[model samples]
Target: MSGHSKWHNIQAKKGKVDAKRGKIFTKIGKEIVVAVKNGGPSEDTNAKLRDVVAKAKAANMPNDNIQRAIKKAAGELNSVNYETIVYEGYGPEGTAVIVECLTDNKNRTAGNVRYAFSKQGGNMGSTGCVGFMFQSKGEIVIEKTDSTDEDELMMLALDTGAEDFAAEEEVFVVTTAPEDFGKVREALSESGIEFLEAGVKMIPDTYTEIDEETAVKFQKMLDVLEDDEDVQEVYHNAEFPEGWEG
Candidate 1:
């Protein structure tokens, strides 16, 4: 994969979400509830739930909020049904885009997503239209600190089943198979290495370089989709011009 990993984009948004703490928590809470409904509330027995808990912790979600979400999910007679849906589209400059959403009302979510695409000079496409342009993988980000040992980190990642490793400008990005993500993360944790972000993501196989003008429009389209309550993630193959600050 060229350019930055999806983890980088998500990390950039972390700061923005920090200011809107409630919004972040709400999104995580919904995921937790969905995990509970899919496979009981016990993190020990449910790998998905465990991953969600880890994600919540990484986001700095309060312990109270986590427990409350689990407790409410455990007690619900008829849980809120959130179906996972993937919407594919083309962004400005023919950038392949994918939007992952967890929505109870597919019509509403689809309408909002389609509107965002149309309003931003893009067009929504049929399912699987752009999905083939990306591959699913586990991505982990670790900030470069004074104590970080580049060689040691690389060794740890390789020994722990990481498939690829890259040193970015501000952080080390580790890639692994989706199934190995938890094991790799656990090993890193035991090695006393803290991660800035870790999750499964759709990584583009190839990049489509976009000019400043197209990048601006593409970013606006992303913002519109991200601002929606149901959109969980948005992936794209856009590689903005070098030194472009997004």
Candidate 2:
């Protein structure tokens, strides 16, 4: 499968999210509580919980926050009932888009998400509308240098479990099944591989390349959704132009 960075549009917003420690903690904290409540806090037995724990650590959420979320989920402390919602739509130039959210109030969250889309010249679609256009996978990003050879990575790591591996502008994007992500990550860590970021994300099966004007609109649509309190992830079938790769 081919890959597109679209990094020029996404990097600034990622940096903004990184700066909001409180927002990051709140989102991951909710995930931890839900994961524990659903499958218990034992990562050894709970794969979903394990993923959330890893996400919490990556977000720099405090130890106490993680523990408290677990305790709350286990009934040792009070916990709120939060629901997971997936909103799908079409963005600028009719790009397929999907947004994942966790919220206690579905009505408010739904309204906000719909409004965000409409505000950016997009429209929300029914559930499962655009979901079929994407595939779910676990992805890891590692910087590329002469020291890390592509053939070596494919043979040592990708061959073992990774579904695909690609050399981006200056980084290697490693892809794996969701179930194998933890094992692959552990192996990479033991092998002394340095990584930038890793997570489970949905990759578009087909891409819609919008003109520059429509690309700006699409970026705005993504940003609005990302800024929402309930939105966890916003994905689209929009690919970056060749000129934007570097």
Q: How close to the true structure is residue 35 of candidate 2, measured as C-alpha lDDT?
A: 80
Candidate 2 lDDT by residue in tens digits, 29-84: 77777788788878789878877776676566777888877776787424478899
Residue pairs whose backbone atoms clash in candidate 2: none
Model 1 Cα displacement at 173 (Å)? 0.9
- The local distance difference test score of each candidate is 0.83, 0.75
The superposed Cα distance between candidate 2 and the true structure at residue 25, in angstroms, equals 2.9
Highest lDDT among the candidates is held by which one? Answer: 1
What are the per-residue Cα lDDT tens digits for candidate 1 across 69-156?
Answer: 9999888828578889999999887889999999999999999999999987899999999999898988888889888998889999
TM-score of every candidate? 0.92, 0.84
Regions more than 4 Å wrong, model 1:
1-15
Q: What's the C-alpha lDDT at position 199 in model 1?
A: 79
